[model samples]
Target: MRLTGLLGIEHPIIQGPFGGGLSSVALASAVSNAGGLGSFGAHVLHPTAITGLVRDLRAATTRPFAVNLWVPHAGEGDPIDPTPHIARLAPLYRRLGVEPPALPVAPDFTEQVDALLAAAPPVISFVMGVPPRWVLDSAHDKGITVIGTATTVDEAIALERAGVDAVVASGSDAGGHRGAFLRPVEQSLVGTFSLVPQVVDAVGSPVVAAGGIADRRGVRAALALGADGVQIGTGFLATRESNAGDVHKAMLHSDAAKVTVLTRLFSGRTARGIHNGLVRELAAHEDEVPPYPVQSGLMQPLRRAAAERGLADYVSLWAGQAAPLTASRSAKDYFKELVGT
Candidate 1:
């Protein structure tokens, strides 16, 4: 297929990049060596850390791999008070025996882009929004393959216009933060089955289907829908090689995973995850939560403390709706099953 040729991999499977410390070099390299496109999410990392991450991944595997970033969207760097959001989570903080953290300073996007370009990885993928023209031009000059994420046909067209090498059709069923940018996330919640073909038809770039895909069946379905490849997240996140904590991985294997929900409580942005106490308690005030990075920063201390203590209730259990279908195994084995080889 075009995606396999474009990515120079034997299989057209891409391991969905996981941020917030869920991605690992071992996991990424394993998939790349196994002839699939492995990815590391470096959005939350500093510029130097991103360079180090690329170096580690290159050392682990000689095959092509991708580094994912979030193109800073609007309002991401705006000054906002976190006091009320902190007050809202006061109970959870007290329960976890952690204090509210100070406001967080997000890493500069321009600096990150420069660092990534200097590292010159084989492929670069973006979500949330498109990077500046200079960033794209620089990547092409370096012979780097650029991929963009889209939740709708219009978004896919936008990426194509921006000259991306490939476009990932990220459906609403996907886990982690929503990548919607052109419109409100609530209006962009299209299912994978419906979104993939439309995106494939709309964009000249190869289309990669994401969201609610775990096993061989999902892969085949995506291919039938004209997708050039498939990207699986929750499936890989549940694997032993992933950096997700034991509690988070265990929850994916349980019945709790079957009851996934889209909520903004975790990071002030809409995302799908296995429903738990935190989501239920804050369901009433989701609209009042501070925007991302702010809410995400305020909850960091509590999430960390809870995770250290093996408490899943307070930790963000990011997973797709296909969590129940996820099997715990090595990433290589999971990739083999996904490609049915």
Candidate 2:
């Protein structure tokens, strides 16, 4: 496959770069060493943590891997005071026996980029939008491959025009935040099968299909639809090597996984996850919540407390629509199952 050649990996499968600390060096290296392209999402990390994470990945495996960043780090637009949002979440924190959450400052995208370039991972994938021309030029000069995530064919065309080495056609069925940058995510809700061929026909770059893809059959379908590779998120999240909380991992394999919902309750951005209590409560008045990262920040205390205390009600159980189909327990085992090795 063209993606396998470009990424220099044996399998056309790519593990999703899960953010918010769900991604781990252990998980990424496991997949990469197994002959697939592993990835870690550095979007939720501080600049210094980003550097350390890349260094750790390099030390863990010699195989090619990717470190992902949100092109426009969350909370970049007109600043919204998170005071009211924090107030709203205060009760939740109190119930969880945690202190009120503090407002969050946006991570410096420039510093993170600089750190990423200095570390020089084989591939640097980004979502939300395309990187600037100068950024792409710098990555190319460093011999790093730039991959962009897109929700629509127009976004794919834009990435190709910007000179990305590859584009991930992220369908609405995927977990976490939608990568819609050109238009509202609702308008960009094309499925993996429909979006892949359209993107392949629209752009010259290789396409990696994401969303609603968990097992080998999904991988075969992606390739048959003209995608050069497949990126699996929810499937990898269930792996033992991943940093996902035990509760979150268990939810992926439970009957509850069959019913996933898209809600902005966790980060003020539409993301797919198991429909739990908090999601049910906040989803009704989602507009009252602050923007991305702000709402995310405001709820950090509750999420942390829930995770530490083994409470699943307040945690963000981020999973794709195909969570119920997740069939692997570890990254190494998953990669072998994916490749039929």
Q: Pick the candidate with the highest TM-score.
A: 1
| Predicted model with the maximum lDDT | 1
Summarize candidate 1's per-residue lDDT along 149-228 as a digit string, tens digits: 99999999999999999999998889999999999999999999999999988888899999999999999999999999
Q: Itemize residue pairs with steric clashes in candidate 2.
A: none
Q: What is the TM-score of each candidate against the true structure?
A: 0.99, 0.97
Candidates' C-alpha lDDT? 0.92, 0.88
Candidate 1: what lDDT? 0.92
Q: Model 1: which residue pairs collide?
A: none
TM-score of model number 2: 0.97
Alpha carbon RMSD to native, model 1: 0.8
- Model 2 residue 164 lDDT? 96
Candidate 2, which segments miss by more than 4 Å at Cα? Answer: 73-77
lDDT of 2 by residue, 1-341 (tens): 78999999999889999988899999999999999999999987888988899889999999999999998844465677767777787778778888875576767788889999988999999999989898899999999999999999999999999999999999888988888989887898898878999998999888999999888889888889999999999999999999999889888888988888878889878788899989777766777887687778778888988988878888899999989888647788888887877
